[model samples]
Target: MGELKLSTKIGYGMGDLAGNLLFQMTVIYLLFFYTDVLGISAMAAGIIFLIARLWDAVNDPVMGLLMDRTRSKHGKARVYLLYGSLPLGLATIAMFYAPDLPMGGKVAYAAGTYILWGMLFTLVNIPYSSLTASLTDIPQERTDLSSIRMIFMLIGVIIVSVATEPLVSSFATPSRGYFSVTAIFSLLALFFFLLCFRLTGKAASESRKKDESYKLGEIWPLLLKNRQLLIVTAASLIGNMAVFIRETSAIYYVTYNMGDSGMLPFFLGIVVLSMLAANLMIPLATKKWDKKGTYLIGSAIGVAGSVIFHFIPYDQTALIFLFGALSSFGIAAISTVGWAMIPDTIEYGELVTGKRAEGISYAVYSFSQKLATAVAGITVASVLQWSGYAANIPVQSDQTLRGILSTLTVIPVIFIVLSMGIIRLYAIDRTTYEGILLKLKEKMS
Candidate 1:
């Protein structure tokens, strides 16, 4: 396969930039928004998250199968990108909108909108992710694509982390502010998705012509037998869990443990910028130590940072940012490498089964991500409630503060460690992948 044009790579990256604008906002603030702004109990909000993600267990695979079978002038995956972008943007706006209703009504509304958002997100994201394999088969280009995607993803994260609060505060009410900011983001997301659709037209058509279709029932056996896919999926899940746990609990940590809610944007900015810095290092790091080795190194760095962050005194705000950035930097490597690794698995699976199911492969991977988000949401909410958290409070009990600190620091370290162990079982190094690709090409010819 030939190298993709720089324009095409960047246009592809824009899809993720669009995705993270809404996604990071939800990861960082939605729970806070539910408990603090909307007056829903933490437990209730957590349950809503769980319910929505559980539905994705079914939704993700179905969408994947649909994409695998789709035939269109626009191509299988890109068709969804063209059509689903607008609905997805609208769903994001709905997710942030605060309805005026009783607690029951509020929970119901949150659940309904959130579920709708997740479904739409799956509709677009599964196809978008699957598009990577369709774009190229070269490992270096895949890594480049993942790196560019992460850079854009982090930029979106920075925008949400740094700007959301100020934007919210600019409005008469927090609710109105969230709604308006989300609307602006939604419009921007729409434009970017469309741009991506336009720029990647050639690659999408190529992917459709080359891809082999498989039956729906084949998904399970293919998934069950693909050991590399299973390992990477598990690792990705745990890594995402660590990320979302820290992200979800960060506001509480800044608000109660540090006694300064105002510094959230600054704190989050430091973390994301550090992640971006790490993302920039990925191509270099992969050269030094292939993807698996690079991933382990990054996880170790994250573990060290998390441990240090846990032990530091809350009053040492500078130290907090320092270690937090360290952890985030490591996390960026894990995320970028993990994504690049997934596309390689498509060929690996095909070599084993004589089948190529990019949509199902990415769908299962996407479902793991959603599951991680759900688990993080519920875990944080339940922990907070158990710690005697009460919203809109000037002060929290020592136990509550400690709970917040642990969720932000210690718990994530545990998840990251587990992810490190899981990834060790993934046997697809550069040599193995190259061999697999060679065999796949032989079989196809």
Candidate 2:
């Protein structure tokens, strides 16, 4: 494979842009959608989140195995991006569209539609992520690709964060507003998918082996042997709990704790801006401290900011925003390097087993991430339910407000710290990765 052109890089980045169009909604608003809009109880919403995403997590590896065996003219990974877009897009709309049904029926609909969306998402997401490993073997190129990809993802996050509340308010009712906004986003998602499909040509297919033969049963052994992958997976699982839970709780924080649901967009926008700035700074941070060191620094900052925010009064809106931005920026610093780390594990796998199972490698990573979200979703919902959160209430009780605060701050701080410790087990560094690549090239020659 030759060097990737600027156009190809943008094309690759667009795929994530498409996925995040729907994903950011789920991360930040899905539970709220189920509870407030669809009239599900908080506990019920938590159960729904748990069941849907656990199934989604379990199903990821199955899709990964199928992708490993896939032989298609359109290309293994890219073909899914082309074909899976419409179904995924439709499911996104359906997840947000609440039907006028009885409580049980609505609960069933939420679970079914959410699960379908997750399935379609895995079909597109695993392939899109695996494509990075195939796009280039150069570590620096992978870094560039990861950075570019995250920048686009942050753009999607920003668009959704800044627009969702205003769009909802623009409609006569919140339900109608959510449906309309998601419908538009779904179309944009499809277009981005098509563009990504067209862009994944020879460059993204570089890692595709002509004579690759691997059984699905071997995936477990591959995962067990790849120590770097395990370390990355564990670290991500812990870290994502903090990220997903904090995101899930932010709207609730702004609404109940800060006394204004109208301010949701403003708070989300600040976080998005912080994330964007952090993404831009990742390359410099990595250069100075390396990925592990940079991630630790970020985690420490996040933990500190989250802890401080918990103690401060919510009436201090300016201080709240400042702490929120600082915490988010730290989280973004850890996330910017996530995709880059997975590709390096591809080389690690090849060296260990003489097979480059990028699909399965990324699947494990994706699976862990989705599983973390499931846990966080369930945890957040359970907390709100236990904490006495009542939907459509003008003001929550002191217990509910306190629970929301813990959800936003203490829970995430603990998880972020745990992840920082877990990352210490990861063995791969620039020196180690370069050595592995050099050895692999020698073997190929």
lDDT scores in order: 0.90, 0.86
Q: Give residue 246's error in model 2 in angstroms.
A: 0.7
Candidate 2 off by > 4 Å: 206-210
The model with the greatest TM-score is 1
Worst 10 residues of 1 by lDDT: 204-213
Model 2 weakest 10-residue run by lDDT: 204-213
Q: How close is candidate 1 to the true structure, as a TM-score?
A: 0.98
Q: Counting only residues 3 or more apart in sequence or on different chains, how many pairs clash (N, Cα, C under 3 Å) in candidate 1?
A: 0
Question: Each model's TM-score?
Answer: 0.98, 0.97
Model 2 Cα lDDT, one tens digit per residue, 268-311: 88988888888788878887887888788888888888888888
List model 1 lDDT by residue over 6-64, tens digit each.
Answer: 88999999999988888887899999999988899999999999899889988999899
